[model samples]
Target: MKHITILVPDGQTSLSSVACIVGSYEMFTRANGYWSQTEAGKKNGTKELYKIELAGVSKKAEFDNGLLTVTTHVHISNISKTNLIIIPSLVRDYETAVKGNKLLIEWIEQQYKAGAEIASMCTGTFMLASAGLLDGKNCSTHWSAADTFRTLFPNVNLLADQLITDEHGIYTNGGAYSFLNLLLYLVEKYYDRQTAIFCSKIFQIEMDRQSQSAFTIFTGQKSHGDEMVKEAQAYIENNLQEKISVEQLSSIFSVGRRNFDRRFIKATGNTPVEYSQRVKIESAKKAFETSRKTINEVMYEVGYNDVKAFREVFRKITGMSPLEYRNRYNKEAVV
Candidate 1:
């Protein structure tokens, strides 16, 4: 079993705990969202004020240079059995500690020297760069911080194009949502294709390989103002396996069919029908890669009742027949 320890500074992005780690994951949060066990606790109301757990790990809370410090002594008084150390995100002032925090810097150096995989998500790359672990190593961070990171760590090979970069056991990802891609990438690497696909489906995300650049997220135009349109889009994503028509979406949103069509097109740059087809096609691609289902079976699974229409849509969107794409990915998987 692989163990992962996530180090969170005073201010860090709060993500779903389930999304962060798979098994036996430990988090060190400084100041963040309140934790709850049941979904009702998170939804309606609860009395939890976000308590921190100090058991199973030694907790060290101190003030250093005007910053609240919370460090966890992981695997202390033992064999130091940590396979992976993750730095999620850090405070904005973390960059100022590049020269300071010699103890933290040395700890990072020692971890890397002892062969623990070091990884960061978002601006956490600053910590790695500050510790000089990324010197001459290829890494990536949130595209927003590329300029500052480049200026600060000139010696580090920075790649802003990709979602994640893995070099010499050091992995870094673009900020926020890019963590999904990073986790999927890691899942594909350490596990099998089926496991990666399963995890992606569970998360309601399309499975994407790391070679695909992270810039895709920025390129998509957002349409969040209209509540009806947003609800329709969410419905489409959740029901990718079911047949969806513009009329059905309009009815669900309690709008006229003509008005819904116009609004959907205006908001998403694609008509409701077109967008739903794209979603189904993307789902089909995942099914093809992850399961032993035949191309026809995948077609039906993605809501294409007619085989001919499914093939045409798949080719139109993917630039290849379903079988062709499947064969290509299969060959690559074998290699």
Candidate 2:
């Protein structure tokens, strides 16, 4: 049987993090039972596919101010080898979580060097990134945490709009609850499409959700300590219905155009034009979600008069057409 170790980090973690541990254990256990009844199981006499274990630096980890405690089956030092390791989401204060879990981080690196695949769920990506495993790799974390993650891990490519990122045997997913989607993807990879679909149906998880873009709420990054950039961000947000230009912003902010562009990108991780587009699209998304406005109505409200331009940009940022987004999010919208 393939060995699967779920790393239980020490800290005040999100409830979802603990859920990932319990959920993963249940998933593989059920997968093993289901596989045993298949024709292939009878042919090869294969029963259990994966032996799952929860491991921590210590025997147990407490969370939520000691309201909850997770007991681990094995210590990190004891598990010298494993096929896969699942890292749960970190606490809100990620820097402290990283600092506190140094042992877990080191163990993760050792395991990866020994040829074990690593998968981090939600903010668990922080642990892998802290271990220097994601320096040049693409990663995904919760959309709300994207700004903070980028500030901390500038070398790693953070695809906040992605639901899952898989490269070099390191897998990551966005959002706290989206780990279910990642679990399903793993099932499809290690088992088969049939088994993955079966698990999805059993868990009531929507299958083939490739992007978390539709769920992201773009709150412009303003903590970079650039007063001019903060003013520019406020301007872009306030003027969503107007056509804002980089040159115009530069002139208004009394900075050179090129210098302004550099400062804006450094502060917000987006060019002035891209920032404007995101702000406009975010406003348009809100209108679609809460109001019975037509696509064109919302587009024009967000300063986009051209139908093709609006549709393309909306789809690019949100991974969905305007009507589709409305139908999915707006309960009153007719499908």
Candidate with best lDDT: 2
Report how far residue 35 has shifted in candidate 1, in Å. Answer: 27
lDDT of 2 by residue, 1-335 (tens): 68989888877477888888888887877776776677755675767677889999888888777878999999989987999999988888999989988998899999999999998999998888889999988999999999999999999999999999999999999987899899988888877777788888888999999999988999899779999999989988888789887889999999999999999999999999989999999999999889998998999899999999999999999998998899989999774
What TM-score would every model get versus the actual structure? 0.47, 0.96
lDDT of each: 0.62, 0.89
Residue-level lDDT for 85 in candidate 1: 69
**Model 1: which ten-residue window has the lowest total lDDT?**
23-32
> Candidate 2, TM-score vs. the true structure?
0.96
lDDT of 2: 0.89
Among all candidates shown, the one with the greatest TM-score? 2
